[model samples]
Target chain A: MSKQFDNVSVVAKANVYFDGAVTSRTVLFADGSKKTLGIMMPGEYEFGTDSKEIMEIQSGELRVLLPGETEWKEIVGEGEFTVPANSKFKLEVRKVTDYICSYLP
Target chain B: MSKQFDNVSVVAKANVYFDGAVTSRTVLFADGSKKTLGIMMPGEYEFGTDSKEIMEIQSGELRVLLPGETEWKEIVGEGEFTVPANSKFKLEVRKVTDYICSYLP
Candidate 1:
């Protein structure tokens, strides 16, 4: 579904990682909360977080192995999963995937 | 550079396009303006728009043929370009490119 935002100011610079396997941009609003909007291509990735992160899958699919979990979980477009603070997680990408990371204090 | 938003809400659903070549998510704020965060992979693509669009290149590179321009221009990470309303443009992607489209009223 299409979404609407009241107002948003995008940061001028972008974040690039892993030889273009991942890229992200930061969006700033009038308030204080922050988020990173990014995309991931087909690859295996491990991510560590300082704070709790809400990983919202915007498109494609991800097979995730959360911290301490033996089974890999599938997350499709429009689906979301959360990682605990100071935790690490792994993702096995089968296809191109888009995502948004909302950090919680 | 990383970005910060005061308060923002992400629309649950994601926008997927072109067989995973592109995908995006909508973000909503308390006010009303809207934005689509997305990424594009390596390929040639043509895009048409109704409203004026500010395409920000977050990562990788893009060779663009703007409306009426016979020569292609390169826009790299942290670069941007504008497309007029009721216009079309072509992009020759040499690498994975991430972008954000801000639609202007």
Candidate 2:
């Protein structure tokens, strides 16, 4: 379900699942989008640059890799960080993880 | 986090917890609100009539009690239903449950 706002739109409800390895669809917004992303495990996954503009892991363990960066940055679990638009990132899921992400428009 | 829209507003992210028996704040919107509510257990909850205008359970188990009603209606897990504004509802959680509730404005 979706709700429209003056400057933002919310996908009110969604049930997303990822197996051992799965690539999510590249979510794009007019300018950006905001969402609550939850990883049900602690493991690793890669996020492409074409993904959302901004990503914030509200809760869970995640490792992020910026565009042109070779090493993964621990963003959650151990610490937290923000990812800029057009930047490539990856997440290392160590266990069942759940987080919230928002893409700015 | 919140984002503004032309006709609606979005509470982008929230982490709500129900400790077996707890009553949530009566969420009120200007005209309405949209939210995804999850019950992390299979039990029951009583939603007062002063709650949001509309509620939709996207997943998991839920039992609803309408205002002035003496019985509860199962809305999820086994079936699904919608709650109108100013209506009183209750949820019966039977197990570890998680469901999304959208409040429409």
Candidate 3:
């Protein structure tokens, strides 16, 4: 799938796939550029961020880990949630899952 | 939860929420506009399109319905699939599901 942004330039696009395992990738983008990331999986995964941000889980199950928090919280299915930037957090994926994540500067 | 496209304009954005049943929405976009849709769900959902298009299921389980085909084919999580534009199709949502769907013109 492809998307074009007339209002903002796309810094990066990725297809993340996991099969009941943990996978992590360090993301780097151009300064002042908004980044959109999508992860498609059939299991569970976790996402961590170092900055304040917004996260949308487009499918499956996800858990959010907050800074200084040892355990994760269930955000339920659908809807939207916010992660404070520069704060470390993790996205745990449960069951077979997929995600489309975008970041705006 | 929000995205800005500098190379294209957003024609519409909607938040789709589902809890285990089938849910669908008819989409209309401006001419020459590219639409980006995201479905954030926890179970399974199916999506159909009339024109030949690309679909990315960001998580969970999804089945694809082909024209003249009575049964749906399982498209595993965390990848992309295509549907021919102008063709009628259905999105069968299974389990506790959510989806983010976008159309580009």
Best by DockQ: 1
Residues B1-105, candidate 3, lDDT per residue (tens digit)? Answer: 232233433221222334312222222333553434443333444455744666655555667676678988775555565667777665654422223345644
| B1-102: candidate 1 lDDT, tens digit per residue | 365343556554456667657666665555666567776778898989999999877777779999999999998766889999999999998877767778
Taking every candidate in turn, the Cα RMSD to the unseen true structure, in Å, is 3.9, 7.9, 8.9
Estimate, for each residue in A1-95, the C-alpha lDDT of model 1 and write its tens digit: 36534356555445667766776766655666667777787899898999999988877677998888999899776678899999999999887
- List, residue by residue over B1-105, the lDDT tens digit for candidate 2: 332223334333334344322211122244665444443444556665444544444445556676667877765444555666777666676543434455654
Q: Which regions in candidate 1 have their CA more than 4 angstroms from the true location?
A: A1-12, A27-32, A76-79, B1-14, B24-37, B56-59, B76-80, B98-105
Q: Write the per-residue lDDT of candidate 2 for residues A50-83, one digit (tens) a residue.
A: 4445454544455667666788776554345566
TM-score of each: 0.70, 0.46, 0.40
CAPRI-wise, candidate 2 is incorrect
* Cα lDDT for residue A68, candidate 1: 87
Which lDDT value does model 2 have at B37? 40
Q: Write down the DockQ of candidate 3.
A: 0.15
- DockQ for model 2 equals 0.14
Q: In terms of TM-score, how similar is model 1 to the real structure?
A: 0.70
